[model samples]
Target: PTMEDFLQPGNKQVAAGYVIYGSSTMLVYTTGRGVYGFTLDPSIGEFCLSHLNIVTPPDGAIYSINEGNYNHFPEGVKKYIEYCKQEDKPTKRPYSARYIGSLVSDFHRNLLKGGIFMYPPTASAPKGKLRLIYECNPIAFLAEQAGGIATDGKNRILDIQPESLHQRVPLYVGSKNMVQKLQEFL
Candidate 1:
């Protein structure tokens, strides 16, 4: 199959979701209305509604990213990382840094717990790394529907025009206020 088979903008999707396979298998999705989550019930062999109409908090005390790439990150992202590590209690500074190097895991945690998950442009990956259509789109859609925000540090994720099937993009998604604060740094 050619790359053209996968070239589609995120905004075209009417629904988007993801499944996490861990100690407890879970599915999360949205239909442009709201975000919902279900857990696989092993005994019943069915998905049971676990979270209904999930809503993300506007502010959080966690930041998820691959800090190993700190030296390679963009100037704005670098500053933002420093800001997350600052020692100001008034605004809940010095947020916890959690990075499992797993997009699904990181995004899922931030979605449920409230935080920012960023995959910004770096020296090695000037245009960013996560694919626009498959990787970023679904998560971006869920983020918005769950009362959060998803952006490329500037533009909305769903509004991005896909140039190729595997096009990579910078992604900054999470609670509304947290994402907006990162935008300020950008």
Candidate 2:
């Protein structure tokens, strides 16, 4: 296969999302135009209409990340978290903190509700935990298509070509407004 076989550099990806295996299995994805969701009908063994064209809000009242390992994150991230804590009425500061440690859940919520989810490179693991190909690229595609942004601090997540499989990188993905404001703190 040619370079076309790889979707590492997220720019090549037309769409991406995952199914939530809850009351039903739902598939949500975007094709650079809009995001859609389909529910699996077990009885008919077919995907049925569940969600029509979905769009994320410009901002929200929550931010998601693993704050339990706060000490491991870089100084910039620490500072940003502090900033998020400080109350600012004008800009709607003191946002709620939410972390489920599951990409599908955290990202899906942020995708629909308009928040930010981040995985930053730290003192020990400089590259961060999220894989460039299998995880970040696809998620970034969906985020962008839904009017959001995804980045690895200094670079766009979709712009990075993997040096190898299992390559890890930091990720900041969600509402365009939230991601932009977070970048300022970083």
Candidate 3:
């Protein structure tokens, strides 16, 4: 895909993000002034700016994973999803459930509201879903430049030099606070 596919005229898009569901799934995006994510809030009937800056909290209260694919995930991922699920219990803060089945939608929420969007390597697709040059690279540039963090759950997305145009990689993005924590887990 090209840059023009995501950029719209007079749409007032401060930032843009999206998920490409292929053999796996990927989330890619960009921003105009500051990075902004598009969150689908049925209550609002539109994708609003749920997160302003990509500052991760020291202890992120929410986590997102494709539970339907749980059987195909790695132990690390299973463990993490377990932690998110635990929030539903009485002891936790009742971390909310938000899986729009759309990468842009999910990342938009995490970027704006402060959380993490993970697309780690699963058993089916070991390299992950997102393409570095066409997808992650652009979004990573926008996110980090706008006070957010973009990574492969371990290293900075911008630092990962690409050898091909469609190189794929796992992606972990959002507020720096949460991003740092997720990095530790990886």
Candidate 4:
């Protein structure tokens, strides 16, 4: 197919989801309504209903980011990291930072558990790394449907126009308030 085929916006995406294979095989996905999970019942060899109508909270106790490149991140991101670790009692200070490096895995955990996952543009890669059409857009769609938000540190992830088939943009997606907090620093 031509590049035009991938020019569709995130809003136009029909569906997006993923499967997690660990102690149990579970399929999680969304169709713009809400997130849901189905577990594979090995005993019966069939998927069983597990999590349904999943809704992420406005704020969560977790924060996910690649701290290894902390020196390469922008000042805004650095401050946000500090904010997450603040010892404030009201906003749940010192939020747990979870970064496993796998986009799908880390994002899946944050999606279901409720938190922020940020992949800001570093010093070397100013455009960021995650592809817009395939990765950011689809996840942004699900984030919104699940009562969350997705952004590229500034604009809405779904609102960004695709300039290329494999466009990369900084990603920040998670609970509504958490995302907003991150944007404040941006």
Where does candidate 2 clash, by residue pair? none
What is the per-residue lDDT of model 3 for residues 108-162, given as tens digits with 9 covering 90 to 100?
Answer: 5565566667788887789888887666766666667557778886667877756
Considering only N, C-alpha and C atoms within 3 Å, which residue pairs clash in candidate 1?
none
Task: Rank the models by TM-score, top first.
Answer: 4, 1, 2, 3
| Candidates in descending lDDT order | 1, 4, 2, 3
Regarding TM-score, does 2 or 4 come out ahead? 4
Highest TM-score: which candidate?
Answer: 4
lDDT of 4 by residue, 67-108 (tens): 999999999999999999999999978899999888877777
What TM-score fits each model?
A: 0.95, 0.91, 0.65, 0.96
Task: For candidate 4, list the clashing residue pairs, or say none.
Answer: none
Which whole-number lDDT from 0 to 100 does residue 31 have in model 1? Answer: 94
Which portions of model 2 miss their true places by more than 4 Å?
Answer: 2-4, 41-44
Q: Where is model 4 more than 4 Å wrong at Cα?
A: none
The 10-residue segment with the lowest total lDDT in model 2: 1-10
With candidate 3 superimposed using the best TM-score fit, by how many Å does residue 70's alpha carbon deviate from the native?
Answer: 1.6
lDDT of 3 at 3: 53
For candidate 1, write residues 22-88 as lDDT tens digits: 8999999999999999999999999999999999888988899998888999888889999999999
